[model samples]
Target: MVSIGYFLSCEEFGPRELVKQARLAEEAGFERLWISDHFHPWNDEQGNSPFVWSVIGALSEVTSLPITTAVTCPTMRIHPAVIAQAAATAAVQCDGRFTLGVGSGEALNEHILGDRWPPALVRLDMLREAVEVIRKLHTGRVVTHHGRHYTVEDARIYTLPEQPVPIYVSGFGPASTKLAGEIGDGYCTVMPDEELVRTFHQSGGADKPVQAGMKVCWAPTEQAGVDTAARLWPNELLPGQLAQLLPRPRDFAQASSLVGRDAVAKQIACGPNPQRHLAAAQQYLDAGIDELYVQQVGPEQEAFFTAWSKAVLPELR
Candidate 1:
């Protein structure tokens, strides 16, 4: 039996709404939660991006469901030591039900600090070192390091859970997958590509949980859902490294203009049909993902949860 989770989009909702949705998600039979960490929305239509650590703190008070950053970029903007401290406190708050999911990062978020975004290869190297720094701090011991990409001076995490928080790594390609296998307690990615999972296992992640997530739009009608998804998340259809390379929300919006409603509709499961939603999730399960997170895009959160609880979740559960 695969575990099913709800993905909270920080880019679309404010802190209060995210907490409320998390509560509703638990009531709707979801077993866990995946929250996105971003400094900016992918496009203007998505609207908001709250500080994720604060939102996670609020989530601790509201829901018991285990939470993980669908992926956070701990390499840039924020130092690994800071992320380590934050994750430690979050683990204690969540009663040890927290996982730290990190990635190399995208320019859209990292560029806001006025730092030049390094190439993907360099970022991966930074990610590896960052993971090491975080792990050392999580041991509740003072750490000092001078590495190629970053330097840490006498840093220690004071608040830690009884058990050390598990760190998961995310990847969209070969290099990152191998890194995840090498250092991650778990693995995360958006696509349900079995080939990637196989690579992860082969590289060193054998038997580790592989987490996957996807987005959908569920509304009264297929066209309504399609339009909503296209308007709010057309960036989903942008190909190649566009998602990683784009430096700002407007850049994404401009690039997304080329994507049509039909493309989004085809890419994302939409409408009232439970079968469509089930089939979408089934792909991840069949691909051997241990955890499956589903996000209902747009403003129909209530409808999406209500419908899924009654119709879709029962079958999947």
Candidate 2:
């Protein structure tokens, strides 16, 4: 059976609320968790981006569900070796119930340190090297490496889980998908594209897990949900590299002006109807997702979780 997980949106909630949400999710029958890691929210309206690792430490005490970083960029802003250390510590804290989900990263988060964001190919190369560094560090041995994009000098991770933390790579395109297969222990992506799942398996990720995440708003009415989604996540409707290239929340908000409530409603599962929510998750399952992660887009997480626990998730299971 495909596992159902709750996605903790760091962009939308503070650290305490995220921990609370994780506890609520476990009570509501979510089997796992996916937490986003970002230095900034997509737009000002989302209003928050807390340090995800700190939040994970809090979650370890509050909830027993396994956690995964929905996607973290270990290539810039934070060095891969540092990420390896953090992931190792997290795994130990979570008692080996952690997965490190990584991606090439967006300028919105990576550019904060005054580092020039490289092109997509270069970022992927950097990500590969970073993953190599992380894996090397996880071995609990001193590692020294001089690579094209990163340098590690006699570094080692002292604390680790008995089982190595699984590293999942995120992909949005063909090249990334191929790389995820080649280098990642598993694959993480938002879309329910069967071809992408097939590609991951055909290339090198056969029998590995593919995780898909989506956002929904369960409100008193459809229009209310649509409005909330549009106001908070209109950037989701932006096509192509706009999500990667837009450096600031204001820029994203400006671009998102073109995205209408109707467009968001059409794409996201919105409203009080449980069927609408079920269908959204069903699409991902049909596309061969091994794990499904769902997030309530706005602050109505209480209603979403209550309704899903009562109605939606039982049917899905």
Candidate 3:
């Protein structure tokens, strides 16, 4: 059976609201949690980008659910050594129920520091090295790494959990997926691509946990749900590397303007239909995902949780 988790969108809600949602998620019987780590929301209309580490601390006090960052980019905007310390502290706070999910990252977040957004291959290489640095630091030994992309001199994280934090890598394409398998303790992605899962297993991720996240909108009516999803997350429909290349929220809004409500309705499971949500999750299951994280797309979180707890989670389970 696949474990179902709730995806707390840091891009959409404040820290307190996220903590509240974590409580609701646990009360609704969601087995685990995935929180997005972003410096900025994809678009301003979605609003609210709280520092993820602070929110994680709040969540630890409220819910016992295992939590994972649904992809943090440790290669840029923040150093891998710092991320190692944060993840280690988070693991301690969560009593070892935390996972560090990392990725190559997008320009929208990583470009904030005025660093040049490298090509996809270079980003993957940097991610590989970043993971290496983080692991070395996690060993509680003094790490002095002078690598091609990063240099860490005599950095040691004094506070760590009983066990080292598990690092899950996120990938969207073949190269990144292969890299994840080679380095990640687990693999995470947004799509239900069977081939990607196979690539991970073939490259060295065999029998490791595979996690994926999907979005849904639950509303009183299907049309209302569609409108909310389209308005808030049309970036989901932006084709190809557009999501990776776009540097600002306005760029995203401009790009997403081309995405229509019908497109969102067709892709995301919306409104009161439990069957639609189930089908969406089933797709990920069919792709051999061991863990599935679901994000409610808009503000109808209370209604969504109530319906899923009563109608959807039971069926999925």
List the candidates' TM-scores in order: 0.99, 0.99, 0.99
Per-residue lDDT for 219 in model 1?
92
The true-versus-predicted C-alpha distance at residue 6 of model 3, in Å, is 0.1
- Summed over model 2, clashes come to 0
- Candidate 2 local lDDT, 149-202, one digit each (tens): 999998989998898889999999999999999999999999989999999998
lDDT of 1 at 32: 97
- Expressed as tens digits, the lDDT of each residue in 22-55 for candidate 3 is 9999999999999999999999989989999999
Q: List the lowest-lDDT window of 10 residues for candidate 1.
A: 149-158
Residue 4 in candidate 3 has what lDDT? 96
lDDT score, candidate 3: 0.95
Given candidate 2, what's the lDDT at residue 91?
A: 98
- Rank order by lDDT, top first? 3, 2, 1
- Cα RMSD (Å) per model? 0.8, 0.6, 0.7
Off by over 4 Å in 3: none
